[model samples]
Target: MKKILSILCFLICVNAFSQILSSNLEKKTLALGEVNHFIIKIDNLNNQQVSAAAKNELLPFHFEEIKDSIGTQPNLYERKIDFSVYEEGKFTIPELEFKVGDKVLKTIPYEIEVINTAQKGDQINDIMNNKEVKLEPKDYWELYKWYVLAALSVIALIVVIFMIVKWGRNKKSSPVVATNQTLKELDSLKKKKYIEEGNYRSFYVELLDISRKFITKQYNVPADVLLTDDLVQLMKTNNTISRDNEKIVEDVFLRGDLVKFAKTFPDKEIMEKDFTDIREFVKRSSNDLEFENLRKDV
Candidate 1:
């Protein structure tokens, strides 16, 4: 009775082990550019190990195994394949074969369909070869009119050149009499001892006027009409002086305004500095481009 009972138990275990080796896949159809996944269940009987391998003839794909428990009962293994197809046709995913000990299992064959869009008719060549219509040329008389106009322009140019040359010679022969007169007036203003006598208002006003006359004679600019800010802004815009000279010009005018209108009393040192600044500004303007032609005669 003991022998017979042991034999029955051995047969029962073998039958249970064979059943665990069998597996099944989820689907057999897929669309192009889609991912298809399936699970494989293996009964780990007789201490058997499970592994998977694949071969494909048409489509490119990837496969991966899923994790499961390793208990006495059968466990599930998963496989995933990605199908990215460009052409319109049916494609086979090939077979994914799994091996467990001496037993071999295969996943079901899969089919994928790739659809393509229709193309429009060709109109590119028609547009590329299209040309515009040309206009007819003008008559000979119209062409002759352009030559007559050009000849007249040359004569006008010659007459203008003669006048310019005559003017240049005259200018070279004569000194800039206006600049000389303005300088003499400035020298007279400098000779006055108004600031020394504590007449700050008269001194600043006359100093500014002399400087303005010099600028007007030398640069042909109306300095008398421009305020201190306007003068500085104009110089900066025209790039007439260096940044340092611009600051000096601004300081001289601003200080002169304070002494004249505000009746602000400055020390002897400041009075001397203002006098020097005004003299220097006049000398600089006398040498600028507007006065350069006159300077050549001198």
Candidate 2:
């Protein structure tokens, strides 16, 4: 009888201890706006390793294992709960139940109070105004028409002024008088015979000036201000002369530069070649306009 009584007392003590271990819970409280944290630690009382699947029955919360170097136990699981609520009221974090094989463990409920924050700016007014506002289509064509009319008026005024000036110039002068004046100036210079006297540098300079003047009068190109390269590029872009004619023009300018700037003494043959190139260029270009006019007349 004494032996049976001792066994019953030992069994009751063991059951009480098991109930106390299973009912262990960790509870926490925090403000709504504040960062809230809760931790539930479970020490593995069993001899075997425990899995996190044992805590899957928790509501409104979840648990993750924590790695701690100071703990002697191998399976010390930690469950952390973060409470996040925007409303200003009391909220409850439900109890959690973790199952490991045949045994179950329960965790306590957590509570948090959420409060409203003070907001600045006219946010409600801006939202109401934006919702009521209506956009109207812009009339761009009406605005553009005035600009187009103004541009046309300016162009017409310029054309009238140009016509009046051109008509006055043509009416006051004769073509024959202009032609005679230019020819007489050239003739007087030729009679000076500066080139035949071996003044090659001066001769080339005068030739370049005369060619520039003729081009300015005949083609309306600003030949006096143009460099040889600029003139060549212009001629090529304009297709003003044939390939053969362009080569002749280039050679004349190059040879003239050598004589005037480099002080190059050319033989009689080269001097004669330069004169021939100049004469041919002038004759060909001058005749082209008349030929074009005749074709138009026909």
In terms of lDDT, the best-performing candidate is: 1
What overall lDDT goes with each candidate model?
0.58, 0.57
lDDT of 2 by residue, 173-209 (tens): 4324434554555556567676576556566777777
lDDT of 1 by residue, 130-184 (tens): 6786544565556587898999999999998999887755443122565566568
Backbone collision count in every prediction? 1, 0
Clashing pairs in 2: none
User: How many clashing pairs in candidate 1?
Assistant: 1
